[model samples]
Target: MVYIIIHLHGRYFIMKQGLFHCEIGMADKLAMVVFSGTVDRLMPVGIIASGAVAMGLDVEVFLTFWGLNSFRKESLTSNTKMSRDYEDMAPMMMQLMKTKNVPSWFDTLKKAKEIGNVRIHACAMTYDLMNMKKEDLADIVDDVMAVGEFVDIAKDAKFTLFI
Candidate 1:
């Protein structure tokens, strides 16, 4: 006896007698465009990247504008402000996070990088515009890259998010 099985998308099939199995494909790469400098927006970027890493997915983060600003060595530790639209909730949110023992976004990203494949790229335009050097940014930043390069890297990603 012989059996054949084929799966599509998320569906799977199993056949007896002659063992055959198929499974759906999952996105192996996660591309993130981090454009915001605020803690509120940055937190999710880290959390999501961490989640992706946990699921065995590669993560690429392209930091531009305010996002690159937030990763500066001088700003990472001192930045506590949320988005302007949520300014009023900053204090409360901070308090809640502290109460819950939530780690900083940078810490989360670092942990993800340590355990999995996570690449952090700083925008070349932002680097030039701000007159910043590689030394001026956090150690987590893998390299400084042009938007075109980053776009090429992200174009093949199975999932992409802008934050």
Candidate 2:
């Protein structure tokens, strides 16, 4: 009983061989292109990842631009900015979350990984352009990959969002 999984053009195709040889389509994956660094925006990424994994779907996150920056070791704690539209309310929101004992966005994302498979990939070009090494990134990040590779991986995903 040999099984192979193939993802193409935003669809998953499973191939079964030997005793059975056939292709089966499935949409059990989530792919996200995280490009923002704002706290509000990043929070949703964590929630979505957690929910997707809870539903038994694999999650692949491509962190590029500001998103990659936020994943840096230093920024993980220091980056407190929120979306510009809601900039003025950041302080209040932060305080409210703290008062309510809500975990930080990064912590939420880490929690999701603990429950299921979650691969976080940094954009190779951004990683190099920013002059950062793998050590500078958080442990949650799986690796650095080019845009093409990320796109290829995302193509087979059932839901791909740019957050």
Choose the strongest candidate by lDDT: 2
Off by over 4 Å in 2: 1-27
Q: What overall lDDT, based on C-alpha atoms, would model 1 receive against the true structure?
A: 0.88
Q: Counting only residues 3 or more apart in sequence or on different chains, how many pairs clash (N, Cα, C under 3 Å) in candidate 2?
A: 1
Q: What TM-score against the true fold does each predicted structure earn?
A: 0.82, 0.86
lDDT of each: 0.88, 0.90
Q: Give the CA lDDT, 0 to 100, for residue 127 in model 1.
A: 91
Q: Which structure among the candidates has the greatest TM-score? A: 2
Error of 1 at 34 (Å): 0.4
